[model samples]
Target: MIRSTFVRTALCALLAPTLSCNMLDVNDNEDVSGRGARVFDPYQSSDSGAIRLSLQQFNGCAILPSGSAVSKGTLNLPGYPDTCPDLLAADPTSARSAPTGTLRLMAGTRYFLNQLTLSDIVLNKHTNGADLTDAVRWMKNESRFRNLDWSDLGRVSDQWTFSTGIEGFSQDAWTREVLFDNARWRTVKDDTFTVEIIDQDGVTPRMTPVVYSRTDFLADSAYGGHTRVGWRMETVQAPQSPGDVVPHPLPVLSGQPASPPAYRTLVKIEMVGSTNPFKTFEAPFIPGPAILKVTWSQLPDEPFFFPIELVTPEGLAPTCANADGQPVACGFGVDPKFKFSTPANGQGYYEPGESFRLFLDMRDGDGNQMLPAGVLPSGKDMLADKANGLLYATQASYFTLLERDSLPAYMVAGPLQKLQVRSDPQAKAPYWSANAESVGLVDSLATLSAFPGVYGSTWTTRYSVNLPQDAEPGTYVALVKTQRYFLGERVAKTNSYFFQVGQQEPTTYPNAVGNCQLCHRGVLSLDNLRHGLGVDHVEACKTCHQRDSDLVPRIQTLIHQLHNSSPRYTQNKTDCTVCHLTKESALRPSMNVCQSCHPSVHGDEYFATQFSAKGEPNRFGNCAQTCHAQSTTNGHILPEN
Candidate 1:
């Protein structure tokens, strides 16, 4: 009995002391209380109980879970020996495959009894700076291994045998593929149940560190001279029953010398973030004999941004709002001028006779309002003039309109001057005062009154055009615009406000956008040069165009100068049709209009004796005599002869 107790105690202390000492406490009654008894059962674990695990990770990137992979090239510490050496004992030339790169993992060690089990390894992830990879970033309050894959790679014993491959150094071309993939680039991943070990007692274990370079190695403090996980048993628990004097299959059948339960551990992993944008995949594994830690790797976040809103308040500005043309909060005229949009459906019933504020909002493709300029200084007046007046030049606003017609000459018209407004996206419209559907879709007007908001600013520049009570009864469109001049000359968004008088009209400003955009295409914001004046869907020039008696800029000439009169408009421009918004024949009002271009075609000096077939005096030269300068008749106006 004495010998049996000694042998069992020795074995228990050698292999697993946690459960080793408690195995003998099955007695119903005993005075073993004074025998220095402390219960530690590795096999039993519960939430908020004993038998806890503590994982200490070395490198920030190393605590990653298996199946964690890196990309195309390898990342090696300077002067470190190359990876994957002597990986093939079966090779004739004994070639060692270079690792694409190295990956880190949550690992721990135990050398108590020369027996290492999952229970011995407490992934010390609970420590500070445990994880650095984007795949996993745990904060102070959150660090608990919830999903773990525990593997029991047999045991390493006090014996000897070394030829080619060691215990857990899983290698081969196949292993390389498993580690990275066929894409032989220097890519790597934490795909294996990779384990690197060093005896806590300083006694060398098994396997060997794969080496191609002999200089330096992994920066992990614990990863200095370690070998891959490889175990060979020096001693294993005998399957015999402890009470039996003779060994028999009976104890084996009864499951003597039971192993500890597998640890279902919790490991934090971030699947995607930063440069590593990878899709998720699973690693192959066999069920081990313990439960402890849980592993996690989640998807990364997406492109993020916040846009600005322009505020345009209706009616006269509040007395305080007139911040000496400086940026005040506009209608609110105070702080918290920072505003988001209100998603709305129905705006008020607007008619020509009624007056209202002109407003607008600029957004990204998602319709999310964006801050077009720098953020205002904490207490800066958003309603006051910013940057001594011209800072708003960056996000400046221009108003224009086009007259709508039945079979119209143009689609829209005029920077209709018939309303007043305060500049502020947060400012409200009396007609649009109804509760909004959602928020953040700002139909607003914003300014760079606040310092550092943007290179430019835009405010509520309103007009009070009297829609003649007797004016033509039809619909008109007003286009609210913010030209991207200071940076790139591009229109930020398309916001057109429409109102009707009697009925809605259909108008076609054929190819206005197509033609005008040709020369107006570049957005050069960095320079001071003024590019072509930008045109929006709202041809607001019609408001001023109604009284054009001079042809110095027949509307066509007005547009010509806007383009800096690029040859596309003159010099090489011979086609009059390019500027006309009409049927070819309808363009000619009379012969006098033609004389402007073909002045030589008419004159008393040139056609003094000329007369038509009738014996009357000819007021102007005939098409053949003056209009067609060619010796022969010009194209189709005159006969071929």
Candidate 2:
């Protein structure tokens, strides 16, 4: 929401090259090697260079049914004061032993509620902003947690806790982990069922159980703070006749009442039913209580910490409905096909300051056509207005032009030059016009004719971009990402398009500085990089990571420091070649890069003084001129391999 009074088109002048806008008579870009400019085509589906499309999805907490009981209060124990308190008592230093609490089961159920658990919790936030120590501590603690001994710690069948689950798989993918052995438990039978809450130390016991009502638990700041906090009924046993009231006691101490005096709840118990694929363990409890029918969708709409899935489209058509609401076949696959269609007679080549138009054939990841195409019920060609342009259907609302502020195209000059959307400021045109598109349709009558009124086709949703008059001449890359609805799920994909502008040969960026595979190993594919683009090489990351005058050093510094702080990165801290592919690339260090590793050697003031020589600080700011020289390599111990 950074609103700017400056016109959007006027902003283009700030980024485009100084060279005059002019068309190239021919494609002189030798780097292209005579390759056709057709990067993606849904109809052909045979272009090896087509940007890979993957489904975008995130896994969310499986919501419980409406009447289920969950903890609702926060417990502030001693030691850690205001950082982030817990809903349950988590004071590890407390010396209390086997503190008892009562549990009551209402009548009409066969078994009484036997197991109680404090589940779905995250305690600490490990951040690497101003202090690197927090991140380092997080890594170490995570390692210890992953390797903890279950036998020695003792298991509490009903209890579960969550973690950020760094460096490995998590039940909810970076969201939750089952902290089964973390809790200590004791079982006792009083007038009503009761259990003892134990401290994590395996020695000190809690004074009294801290159980919050479902409402209070959800209201705590930490309840929705990081992940979620709530207790679970892990197991149940013993038959109780109708109307039998078994009491569970949770008393108020200094601050607030642990929970209400009494509240009826519907609990989902372990039973013979479809299993949750994400759960790590099988049924820890025997069959008890009635099972509730629940449903979930693979479609990921809700945002999680980091939510995006990368996978090649299977081209599998999903079941869809026609405009008439009748069942129909959605053509095939959700990966939208794209290709340049503007600047006619240019042989797929573009020039500076040219009208650029690209065609995107929209499809739901499931084969449903997103935009209306084919023949209408009136027997008129759906694309009859191709001479002009067709308006998008209401469903087009699902399509989003990501990175609206900054146009997706980048000029691969000395550094990455962000291309702006062409605008007319003098005419008072909005600066955002560069990202604006006059939506149109491409003829798909050849194939879509058969699916008349079925609400689908191999039609293209067109976008027209007017390149700035002073647009730089070089290879231009457009990383297009669009999201659409697929069946009941939200799906998206990102693809890269390479086209020449202003005739310098279309050479790829010199991004071979780092040997990413040395550490990433077999997982260094495009999907693993997870930046959305399908290009296998790391340079594809530059699409967004390109040096921005405003946000350059922050990312570089964080990345460098994060790697140096990782417990898993065992290489010598100064070993540049471990990641750098060539000695020259490693030797060409900038002040920002050096400072990331040697924070204690100098202060920000000194770095800024050196950058003053280059006018304004940017990605190219270097220390070699003012301080570090060739001898800077002498400080590092290079591997002999």
Candidate 3:
């Protein structure tokens, strides 16, 4: 009985040690104190607690539930020698296929512990057979690995192997299109291990599948160099599950019909402001990411490419708040949303009816600044003058903004006094001629005479006329000449109206024809030259003539000399009869004689006469002779004479 007790005691001693060893191993593997399982605490610090929990949660449960096996799995990955020599250098060149390896995984595990000892793992030379440098430099400068947080992983030793705890997870096979390559994959297995390969070019080493446990569950995870690498835990059925059921529905067919595309709403803005005659408001345009539609009137015909930018109120002068209560820039092309800096010495904004004076800083599409004169300048005031003074005869001349397929519409603004005229004249009585000669009138007198039908009361007229009691009873002609102002000078001339007058006999003379002082109230005389004479006497031969009967001949000669001497009045020295007739005869009423008195009025040469120098006496020549004839002259000269 004592011997049996001894044998039992010895057996108990042997079993006691074995039992203690078992308990220690179980404590190391099981999740205790609510700490996560499968988390290898190499540093064993409070800071690692969160990382431990995350890893365990991601893997579903700890790999070794209390009292499990301690043997860990071995992972061997195949390396492509030709394409990736750094990983597959040990393999023979003839073996184009990857070098196969094995991973010894303990059965029924959620996570695995692997000691990647530096001495056990070997880094192959790169394609150029260059040795790998510092891993930190590779992670930072290499494109592929630049985004990876290297501090999160273990450090690289002289042997370049990293010791880590990997969570075992499964993924369904997925196909991905390789960038810049046509090689497609039908299916791949989920990989259990990962390693970074450094290239000789110092590029970030790409992490490729080294070992995949389930080929059917693997996915093609190739991505561009910039793609981020991360992992997520998924609860997938074990490969050895009992049921034969499809896990997820096949991905919905690609290229399915989609809804029609939608378009963005566009807002249109119109800027209105006063303009000056001397400056142009280059209408400002505001640009944004959205498509812009600009609408304006009084703009140039061509599209004005301008530099557009957002601006604050302080940066833009003459700015005012728009309807939306936002400050808008003023001046030519001032867009409310945009700020503009004009050229140096710019006159800035201009008010309507004010002299325009702003100059724009021109630019090209590339935003290169240009000089004002190189494009358009304020000094060239043509555009401003046109905008302020001229009316567009056609709708097209007005400014407009139109869509690609739309018809152009006109703007509503225009210059003042669109159409202007200078004067109106009354017709002569008793066989009156539309020609100016018959009326014995010159210049425009309709304005001064206050003639009812001659000068309309709406605008000012330069002159008006009155007739004398001794004026001829025959028909006389009247004339009105006008000059248009442009750039401080007359640029155009026009004649407006012509009408007839009847004889009132001796009973009365029209008040308009009776008052010469109405138009000629201001007068100044210098020697024989009388300027500022009444409109009636402006060009009248009698204006300088006296009533002495003996002086009639002398007055005629004096009148001829005065016209001949004035350069502004005549082109050359010529005889009085060259433009006038001394007789009342029809054939003697020289058309040339009338032309001589109003030479410049006809502009250039006058038409030739049909009558000869000795033609039969006509009423025109007969009247001329009655006034100024040779005392010894015989009867009228015949054409045959």
Over 1-641, each residue of candidate 2 has an lDDT whose tens digit, in order, gives 01123233223222333211211112222122211121222211122111121111101111111101111113222221222221112221121232211111111111111111121222233222223343333322432122212223321221111111112211111011111222111111111112222332322432232221222111111111111111221112111222222322333444532432211111111111111111111111111221111111111221111111111223223234445645454432244445565444433346666776665544444444444443211212212222111122221011010011111122222112232211111122211123311211322122123435533433334556677777665555554554322211222345554555666344344433434433432212222222223323344443333222211113344356557744345678777665544444454455555555664345434533322212445324545554566566457855343
**C-alpha lDDT values of all predictions:** 0.22, 0.29, 0.19
- Model 1, position 587, has a per-residue lDDT of 28
Q: Give per-model CA RMSD.
A: 39.4, 21.6, 51.7
Q: Estimate each model's TM-score.
A: 0.24, 0.38, 0.15
The model with the greatest lDDT is: 2
Q: In candidate 2, how many Å is residue 121 off?
A: 10
Candidate 3: misplaced stretches above 4 Å? 1-480, 496-562, 567-574, 581-641
Question: On residues 220-269, what C-alpha lDDT tens digit does candidate 1 reach at each position?
Answer: 11011112121111111222222222211111223234222111112212
lDDT of 1 at 337: 13
**Candidate 3 lDDT tens digits, 322-375:** 334443332111100111222122222112222211122222111222221222
Judging by TM-score against the true structure, name the best candidate.
2
Model 2 residue 571 CA deviation in Å: 5.0
